[model samples]
Target chain A: MSVFIIRRLLQSVLVLVVMSMLVFAGVYAVGNPIDILISPDATQADRDATIRAMGLDRPMWLQYAYFVKNALAADLGKSFAFNVPAIELILERMPATLELASCAMLMAVVIGLPLGLYAGLKPKSFAGKTIMTLSIFGFSLPTFWIGLMLIMIFAVFLGVLPSNGRGATALLLGIPVSFLTWDGLRHLALPAFTLALLNIALIIRLVRSGTQEALLMDYVKFARAKGLSDARIIGVHVLKNIMIPIVTVIALQFGSVIAFAVVTETIFAWPGMGKLLIDSINVLDRPVIVAYLLIIVTLFIFINLLVDIAYSLLDPRVRLGESDS
Target chain B: MSQQPALSTATPVLQVSGLETHFAARNGIVKPVNGVSFSVSRGKIMGLVGESGSGKSMTGYSIMGLIDAPGKVVGGSILLDGREVRGLDAESLRALRGNRIAMIFQDPMMTLNPVLRIDTQMVEAIQAHEDVGRHAALDRCRAALAQVGIASPDQRLKSYPHQFSGGMRQRVAIAIAILLKPDVIIADEPTTALDVTIQGQILAEMQKLCRESGTALIWITHDLSVIAGLADQVCVMYAGRIVERGSVDDVLDSTAHPYTLGLLNSVPSRNPRGQRLRQIPGMTPSLLNLAPGCPFRERCAHATRECLEDPLLEPVLGHPTDAASAAHQVSCHHPLQTGIST
Candidate 1:
């Protein structure tokens, strides 16, 4: 298992290197950041000095080499927009995004698992069919639109929930977390629900299909014959088998939720990495963009590794080795 | 073993009569187990022999009340130790199952949850019906595993089903079934997927367990040789109906129903070497929209005009009907004469 983890770590490093090169080249292709860095009416000499100072005057390869050299020392250059280390800027926004994504995932599993299991177990019952039909709406509705609807209903009409921003935070282990405060949770509700909509739908479908298939397995019938209560059978036998796929999908979805929650975050004005990424992109903040992309690549690699470990944990047939027994 | 009183004098552990299980398909209501009846006494093993789609497995499932939706036990009287179990409420049925009655399925690989440890599966089976403490349950599970001929029960119990060989997995399943020491166990071809040597060992273990504990076993299989050796009574099923039933020796030696004869003839060892193996002609008739007659008439070589009417189970000529245990019954328009060799 240690060897497997070590190999995965090495692969993650390779991916981050490739991603760094790609991000640098891709940001370079976009209109120059120097124009936005300095005033529009600045003199040519002023422009030249700023460009040289920022190391933008060098050839793209040399610039990438310097970026890589600094990156190896945990130094992602300063964001042009924020005037702070790009990594530091992203890390500052990380907690909000992580909290929101975690809440969304929690909601997805809490709500989707039972509904999906019911739908799969019955499939033809009226309640089961109704749950499935509602899940379709969760999938089809756009996140931004859902975010707006939730805001209008809870904020505008009901006047119960805060529409935008992280309302309040309490220091938990020296990290500001909104969920600890009622006002902060109220602020979190709209954006988190919007972000969770698609994932809930996906989990419902995955678990439903998985449960339906599992119900037909001889083991399930044997369990029934063993006089196990329906709750025990579904909870233990069915849930364990379906968890392999659910864990993989949910982990990957959680990564995407953190990375691509831009629309919902923007709509709700939630200060997260997604908002930082969007703002950085608009200003052509090359360092921030590169840092963000590399972090996301690393997250995906880490999540994939976690999924493999989870797979082995869930399925006894899967062993963490080159050759499976 | 000391001889006990005749099986007929004492109440059988399980008596199933007119058990009909039907499925609602798009086409029609398919009767898989159409009016089957049999009884097994304590410590006796009754073999239910049939080909694929012959409703043998369905009968076992129906007995366990394990039939799923779109299929149900439409009609039946299942008496477990003289208590009617058929049509019992869900809770009551569940209480009886894995407690007073248990089942072992055909494929051991598929019967056990692959993710669960052997101990977890066995412990849960016992705890499901009883309020036993975990330690007591674990002890029972360990003993059950050892009873099924598994070595080092402590180590084996910690492993998952995948860690064991196919034969060993089946033994685990058997161990779970016998954990509660249920009065009756319906083994649905539990040894069918195993090698001959493993099959033989399992059969011996099951027989020994039954003799020692007085558990009535309903061993369902299509292999006549398995029935010939392991079963005291045999019921040959044809197209959802029992075509022949009697003492195993009587049924194998003087097979009455032509379908039973055909099954015996089709055994590769029974046929002459280098000759085309004898096969019963025609396919099994579909249960959906079946004609009102003997289900095996289409395949029976002796099918005649009188066969158009369904045949009722009746005693074979010269068989002693005085003792129900010794009665040799066949459901056929014309049962083959006694002492007729295939």
Candidate 2:
């Protein structure tokens, strides 16, 4: 297992290097940094001084080497648009995005899994049929559209919860780990629910199919023949078998949950990385974009690794070292 | 062999009569179990032999109350030791299953959870139906494992179902079934996936356990040879109907109905050794498009004009061992007789 993890880590390092190089080359190829140096406000002498100071006058290869070297040392360079260190800006925005994704995922599993299990247990019953239809609609509708619907309903029609932002009042909780609105769930309810609604729909579909398939397996029949009650049969036998697939689906989608939150954050003005990254792209903040891309990629790879480890824990048949048992 | 039908003799542990199960589909209803009737006394092993789609498995499921969705028992009287089980509530039925009656499926893995440890699953199974403590349940689980011929019970219990080979999985499954010490056990082709040697061992162990514990057993399978060796009474089903039923020797040797005779002759051992195996001519008719008359008439060699009308089970000719209540009964207009040619 340790050997497998070490190999995976080595492979990840190689992949990260290759990906960084590609992004660096593509960004460099798009334009000349000297163009940014030679602004309309600058005279020829000023432009020359600026180009030399920023090392933009150097050869492309030397410029790339310096960029890589500085990036490695955690100096992501000053963003042309923001006039601040790119790494520092990304780090400032990371917590809110992580908070939203984490809360949404939590909401997805808690709400969706139970609903799916209930539907699976009584497929022919009235409740099961209702849940199935709702999920189909949930899965079919677009996430952003659902988010808009939620805002229209809770914010506009209901007039109960706040539409957006962290909170009007200071939170009692020490140092918010997630979005200020979400960190204080009392205020965080609306935005979190808005983000969570689509994920819940997705998770419901995944868990429903997984549970339904597991319920039909011979082991389930065997468990029933053991005279196990319907609840026990579903909880222990069916749920356990269904979890492996559910975990994978949830893990694989976590990165997308983070990426897709851009639209939601923009609409609500929720100060998360999604909004930050999009704003950076609009102004063409090169350093910020690079840093954001690397961070998102790293998070995705880390989540996938966590899922792989979880797979071995769930089913012993899957040994980490060998492809085939 | 206690005579006088009374509650004193345990009321024939499982008495099934006029069991009619049909599948209601979009096309039409398919009547798979048409008035099937049988009774299994305590300490008795009744073998239900049938070909594919003969409703043997359905009958087993019906007894366990495991039938769900499209299929249902339209008409039946399932009595477990004189108590009616046909209309019992779900809770009552669940209580009865596994505690008083247990079923073993063909695939052993069906009975064993692939992800769970043997000990955990078995102990849970034990604790589910009984209020026994964990340590006591664990001890019982260990003993049950050892009883099924598993070596080093503790280590085997700790291992997952995948760690064990096919035969061993079946043994573990058998152990789980017997762990509850149910009054009745329905083994539906439990040994079908096992090796011949392992099959023999399992059969021997199962029979011994049933005999010793006085647990009534309904062994449902297509393997007539296994039934011939293990069963006390043999009920032969053809297209969901029990065409012939009697003692194991009587059904295997005499084979009064043409379906039974054909089924017997179809097997390699019963046929002439050097000659090509004689198979039953036609396939089982689809239940949806079944003829109004006998379901097996298309496949029976002796099917005649009279066979157009459904034939109730009747005594075979020249068997005057109590004609009113003979040991053998065959469902055919023309059963094999003293001078009737094959």
Candidate 3:
């Protein structure tokens, strides 16, 4: 088991390095560093110096090698436009998006699983029909439209909650994380629900289908014949069998949740990486963009690794040294 | 033998009467089982023989209350110990299923959970209907495993279902069913998938166990040879209804229903090892779009114009065929008489 984890972690490292290099190459191909430095109005001498200092005059391989070295050392350098450390800017905005995505994923699992199980176990019953209809509505509605509707109901009409921001204008517990929107979860009723509601619908349907299929497996019939109650049969036998695929879908959705936070943060005016990324993109902040892309890629690869370990744990039929069943 | 009250001397442990189960489909609702009746006494084994889709498996499922959507018991009763069991609720039905009447399926994998260790599954099955401590349950599970010819019970119990071979898995399933000493066991082709040697061993084990414990068993299969060896009584079914039934000897020997005779003649038995097996002439009738007449009339060579009326089962031709065949019954308007007919 330890060897399997070690092997998986090593593969994850290889995956991240390959992804980072690709991103670096793609970003470099778009435009030159000299464009930022020698704005058409700059003097000839300043342009020459900026080009030399940024190493734009060097061969592409040398430039990329230098970029990789500085990148590995966490010296994301100053953003071309923001004139601030690239790492610091990205970190500043990451918390808000993380908080939103976390909340949304949590809500999805909590609400979706039971709804899915109920739908699968009792197809065509009253509760089943109600859940199915709601799920359909949840899936069909656009994410942004739902977000807007929530803002209207909770912010504009009800007036019981704040429209946006991390929290109260002041810091709590004497610690300023600078990601006010994350602290704003105390007032996150609308944004979190908007982010989660659609995902919950998607997950519930997936879980319900997986559960229904698992329930039909011969082993489940075996468990029932042993006289286990319907609840026990579903909870233990069905859940364990279906969890591997469900975990995979949930992990894949985790990436989307992060991406969705971008639009959500912008709408709510929350200080998360999505908002930060968008703000940087509008002004064309290079270092910060590079840092954010690299971070997201690395995080996705890392979570995928975690999912692999989770799969091995859930099903003993898979092992590093043996053939899979 | 003295004249004795048949009910007192030979009360059946399970009596299924007029049990009709129908399944509704887009085409229409078709009765898969129509007015089938039979019984098994204490320690006796009854084989229900039929072709696929002839409702033999459905009968077993009905007895176990495992029938789900699209199908339902439309008529008749299932009585265990003279108590009606047709309409018991979920909780009571579950209580009775694995406790008093257990079923072993054809696929051994359907009787063992892949993820769990054999010991965990076995012990849980035992304690599901009993209030026993873990240790006692485990001990009984071990004994049950040993009883079914699984060597070194302790070692085998810790292994998962995947670790065991197909025959071994079937033995484990049979062992769990026997552990309860259920009043009636419905084995739906439990040994059909096994090799001949393994099948013989399992059948012998089941016969010994049931005989010793006085547990009635209903062995459902399409194989007549299997019934010939294991069952004390046999019911021959065609298109979801009992075509002939009697003691195994009377039914297998003093043949009545043409379908039963066709089944017996079709098999290349040891008695006629070199002879060409006689094949039945036509396919089984479709459950849907069934003709308004006898379902087997198309395939029965002896079918007559009277067969188109859907004949009711009674004393075939009103003839007292055999003194020993009083209990024997055939559902045909014209049953073949004894040696003179053959």
Candidate 4:
């Protein structure tokens, strides 16, 4: 098992090496950040000095080598907009995004899994049919559109919650979170729901299919025939089997949940990395774009490793198989 | 035998009478188990033999109350030890399942959860019905494994289903069924997927276990050869109905139903080399398109006008044995008789 993880970590390092090249070349290839960084009225000398200071005057290969070296030391150069290390800026906002994405994930699993399981259990029941029909909107409709509608219903008209922004923040376990207070939670509800809607839809579909397939399996029928209670059959037998796939789907999509939070963050005025990315994109902020790409890509690889670990843990066959290999 | 019928000494461990399980398909209702009836006495193995789609497995499922949506035991009295199981509520039925009545499916993979360890799954099966502690359950689990001829029960229990060979996994499944010494076990072609030698071993182990525990066994299968040496009694099924039933020797030697005769003739036994195996003429009649009369008349060698009407199960006259073996019965308008030529 340790060997498998070490192999995975080494593989991740290899992937990052390839990714560093793409990030350096790709960010430099796009629209110039210098256009937004300095005034148009500035003299050629002033521009030259700024370019030299930022090390843009160096050959592309030399600059890429420097970027790789600094990146290895956990130092992404200063953001063109914020004038702080791009990674520091990312790390500062990381907590908010994590809080929001995880909450949305929590809501997705809590809400979607049960509904899907129930739907699967009684495919012919009216409630099952109703849930299946309603969940389509969770996937088909746009996130920005859903966010506006939620704000309109819960905040503008019903006057029960805040419409935008992450509410008053407090530290929990040394990490600042927006959901500690009632006001914060109220503010969180709509954006999280918006971000969670598609994920909820995806999870529901995944669980429903998983459950339906599991129900037909010989083990399930055998369990039922053995006179296991409906609760135990569904809860222990069915749930345990279905979880491997659901966990895989969730882990594979966690990075996307963070990546796709852009629209949800913008509409709700939530301060997360997604919103930061958009601001950086608009100004053609080179360092911030480069940092975001590298972080998200690295995160993807790490999450895949976690998924493998979780999978083997859930089913010992994988764990034992890994040892043999 | 703990839950054996209190009212009568004659009460069999499982008494399925006029069992009818139907499925509502697009065309119409498909009768998967059409009026199937049989019984297994304590310490006896009753083989339920039929080809695929003959509703053999459906009969087992119906008895276990495991049939789900679109399929239901529409009419039947499945008396497990004289207790009516047909219309029992889910909770009541659940208590009886895995406790007094257990089932083993054809695919051991189907019977065993892939993700669960053998010990965890087996113990859970017991604790689902009984309030036994984990330690007690584990002890019982080890004993059950040892009973099924698995060595190193302790280590095997720690292993997952995938770790065991197909034959060994099935042994674990059988062990689970017998863990609580259930009154009846409905085995649905449990050895069909196994190799010949493994099948023989499992059959021998299963029969021995039933004899030792006085647990009635209903082994559902498509192979007459598998049942030949294992089952004490046999119930031959056709189109969801039991066509011929009797002591295994009596049925095998003096088979009355043409369907049974056709099934036996088709077996690839010591037939002459280069000769085609004799087969029944037609496919199994579609349940939806079935006519009013005999299901096998189309394939039977001797079909008469009398066969157009459904035949009631009649006592077979010539068992030529002890009075107990004379309980043989066949459902046919023209059962092979003393004077009648095929």
Candidate 5:
């Protein structure tokens, strides 16, 4: 198992290296931040001085080498716009996105699992059909549109929830998390729900289909024949088998949620890394963009590795280093 | 033939009469187990022999009350030790299953859950019906595994199903079935997927287990050789009904039903060494929209106008009325004469 983890870590390093080069090159291709960083009234002497100070005069490869060197030293360069370390800027907004993403994922699993199981168990029942139909709407509706509708209903008309921004937050483990406070949770509701809507639909479909297939497996029939109670059979036998696929999908989706919540963050004006990313992009903040992409890549690699380990854990047939049969 | 007085006098452990399991389809209701009847005495191994889709497995499922929706035991009286188990509520049926009766399925690979440890699966089977503590249940599971010829039961119990080979997996399933020492066990082709050597070993073990524990066993398979060696009584099923039933010797030696004769003739060992093996003519007829007649009429070489009429299960004529032959019955309008060789 340790060997498997070590191999995965090596692969992850390779992926990180490739991603860093791609991100650095991709951000470099974008128009220079110098245009936006300096004013039109600035003299050429001041501009040259600013460019030299920022090491903008270096060749592209040399700049990338410098970036890699600083990255290895745990310095991802300073944001051209914020003048703070890019990693620090991202980390400052990390808690909000992490909390929101986690809440959305938790909501999706808690709400979707039983409903999907029910739908699979009784595909012909009226309630099952209704839940499945509603899931379709969840999938088809755009995230931004859903966010707007939620705001309009609960915030605009009902006036119960705050329409925008993270409400009062308390420091927990030195990280400001909104969910710990009721007022902050109220502020979190609309955006989180909107974020979870698509994932809930995906989870429901995945679990429902998986459950349906699992119900037909011979082991399930054998379980039934063994005189096991319906609860034990469904809860342990059926649920464990279906969970293999669900775990992989949910983990990948969780990673995507944290990284690509830009639209939802923009709509709700939530102070998150996604929001920071958008603000940085508008000004061609190369350091923040490159850092953000590299971080997201790392997150995906980490999630995929975790998923492989979890997959092996869930299914006994999936050993660590056995060649594929 | 001298009758075994003990077999005739003892009360049967399980009796089913007029069993009918039907499935609803878009075309019409398909009768998979149509009016089947059989009884198994304690310590007896009854072989239910049939080709694929012969409703042999369905009969076993119906007895366990494991029939799913779209197919149900619509009519039947399943007397388990004199109590009618048919039409009982789910909870009541569940209580009897894996406790008083258990089942082993074909494809040992599929019978056990891939994700579960053998110990978890076995212990749960005991705890599901009984209030036994986990330690006691684990002890019982270990004993059961050892009884089924598995070595190092302690190590085998901890391993998951995938870690075991196919034969070993089937042994685990058998161990679980006998864990509760149920009154009856319905094994639906349990050894069908195994190699011949493994199949023979399991068959011998099952027969010995039955003899030792007085557990009535229903061994379902299409292999006549297996039935001849393992089962004391045999029931030949075709298209959802038992076409022939008798003592193993009487059924195999003086086969009455022409269909049974066809099955025996199709065996390569029974046929001439150089010639091509004989196969029963035609596919099994669809249960749906079946005409009111013998289901095998279309395939029987001896079929005539008389076979178009439904035939009742009746004793083969000219056979003595002794207790041994009395138990032998055939459901064919034109049963082949006695003393006919395959």
Candidate 6:
């Protein structure tokens, strides 16, 4: 197990190196951000000084090397827009996105698991069909559109909740959380639920199919033959077996949830990494773009690593066999 | 046959009469187990022999009440200890299962949950039916595993299902079935997947366990040799119905039904070397829309006009049909008087 963890950690480092190269090159491939950063009336001398200061005059390879070395030292350079360290700015905004993403994830799992189980177990039942039908809207409807619809209904028409922003946050573990207060919960509900809708739907579909297949497995039939009650059989026997895939999907989706939060963040004007990303992109901030993407890529890789670890823990065959079964 | 203690005095451990199970398909309802009836006395093994799709496994499922959606026991009575088990509520049925009766599937992997350790699964199997502490249940699990001839049960209990070899996995499954010393055990081709040597060992061990513990067993398999070697009584199924049943010696030496003869002839072991092995002619009739006739009529060599009509399970040989010698009943219009009537 220790060997597996060590091997995965090594793989994650390699993945980050390769990914950093792609992000560095990809960011540079876009037009220079200096055009937007400087005034149109600026003199050539002024532009040259800005270029020299920003190391734009340096060869692309050398600049990339500098970026990698700085990233390795936990210094992602200064953002062209904010004029502050990119890493520091990202760290500042990380908590809000993390809190929101985690909450959305919590909501997805809390609601989706039982719903999926019931639908899968009784796909032909009335409630099962109804849940499945409703879940389609969660999948097909646009997240921003859903966010707008929810705000219009609860915030605009009913006035039951605030229309936008993270409201009334209290510092918990140095992370400002909105869900601590009822008013904050009301404000957090709309966008968080909107972001969660797609995840919940996707998770529901994944779990439903997985559960349906697992329920048909010979082991389940054997469990039934052994006389385990419906509760124990479904809970202990079926649930654990099917959780392996669901956990993998959910973990991988976490990165996407943060990335996809762009539209939701903009629509709700929530102060998060998504909003920060948009602000950086508008001014063509090179350092911020690279750092944001690198962070997301790192997050994605780490999540995948955790999933591999969870896989081995969940199914012994995965740990024992060469192929991940 | 010789070793079985006089078991007739006690009520048979399992009894199924008119067991009919239907599976709903797109085309029509498939009658997999139609009017199937059999009983296994304490300390006896009844071999349910059939080809693929013969409803042998379905019969086992019906007795265990394991039939689920798309398939149901429409009309039947599964009697465990002389109590009608067909209409028992799920809770009561669950109480009877893994306690009064248990099942071993064709795949050991099927019987053992992959995520759970053997000890966890076995202990839970016991605890599911009875209120017992973990250590006490573990002791019973080890005892059961040892009884099934597994070595170092203590260490094996900690291992997961994947840790064990195919044969060893099957032994663990067999151990689970005998965990509670269930009055009856329905093993659906438990040894079908194992090699001959492992199969032989398991068969011998199982026969001995039945003798020692007085557990009635229904061993379902398509292999005739397995039946001949392990079972005291044999029921040969063609298509959702038993065509022949008798004592092991009587049935193997001189079977009454033509399908049974066909089954015996098709075995490669019975054929001479360098010659193509005999196979029964024609396919099994589709149960969904079977013609109004015997299920085996399409494949029977001696099929006559009388065979076009459904043949009641009757005594065609010296053994009276459904009589005390249920061991010798043959549901055939024309029984083999002198030899396999081909």
Candidate 5 vs. true structure, TM-score: 0.98
The TM-score between candidate 4 and the true structure equals 0.95
> How would you encode candidate 4's per-residue C-alpha lDDT over A1-325 as one tens digit per residue?
7778788788899898898888788878887778888999999999999999898889899998988888888898899888899998988888888888899999999999999999998888999899889889988998889988998899889999888888888889888898898888988898888888888888888889899999989888878877777788899889989999899888876788887789989888899999999999899888898898888988899898888878888876676324544
* Tens-digit lDDT track of model 6 for A219-303: 9988887778899989999999999989988997788998769999888888999999988888889899889998998889888
Q: Which candidate should be chosen as best, given lDDT against the real structure?
A: 5
Clashing pairs in 4: A218-B110, A219-B110, A226-B97, A226-B98, A227-B97
Deviation of model 3 at B60, angstroms: 0.7
Ranking by lDDT: 5, 1, 4, 6, 2, 3
| Candidate maximizing TM-score | 5
Listed in order, each prediction's TM-score against the native is: 0.97, 0.93, 0.90, 0.95, 0.98, 0.95
User: Mind giving the per-residue lDDT tens digits that candidate 4 earns over B208-283?
Assistant: 9988888999999999998889998999999988899998887888888888888887887834568987788889
Name model 3 segments beyond 4 Å from true: A32-42, A74-78, A81-85, A168-183, B1-9, B268-277, B289-292, B315-324, B338-342
Report iRMS values in order: 0.7, 1.1, 1.7, 1.1, 0.6, 1.0
Q: Give per-residue lDDT, candidate 3, residue B104.
A: 89
**Can you list each candidate's DockQ?**
0.89, 0.72, 0.45, 0.79, 0.88, 0.76
TM-score of chain B of each: 0.95, 0.93, 0.92, 0.94, 0.96, 0.94
> Which pairs clash (backbone N, Cα, C closer than 3 Å) in model 1?
none
Q: Can you write out model 2's per-residue Cα lDDT over B12-83, one digit (the tens) per residue?
A: 888899998888988888877888999888788999999989889999998898887788888989988778
Task: For residue B306, give model 1's deviation from the true position in Å.
Answer: 0.7
Span of 10 residues, lowest total lDDT, candidate 6 chain B? B1-10
Tens digits of per-residue lDDT for model 1, B3-71? 234545258879999999999999899999999999999999999999999999999989888888789
Judging by TM-score, tell me the better candidate of 1 and 5. 5
Write down the lDDT of every candidate, Cα atoms only: 0.90, 0.81, 0.80, 0.86, 0.91, 0.86
Residue-level lDDT tens digits of model 5 in A1-325: 8888788789889999998998888888988889999998999999999999899999999999999999999999999997899999998998999899999999999988999999999999999999999999989999999999999999999999997999999999999999989999999999999999999999999999999999999999999888999999999999999999899889999999999999999999999999999999899999999988888898899889889889898999898866633
| lDDT digits (tens) for residues A249-279 of candidate 1 | 9999999998998888899999999999999
The deviation in Å at residue A236 for candidate 6 is 1.4
> Worst ten-residue run, lDDT, model 3 chain B?
B1-10
Model 3: pairs clashing at backbone N, Cα or C within 3 Å: A93-A273, A166-A180, A166-A181, A166-A184
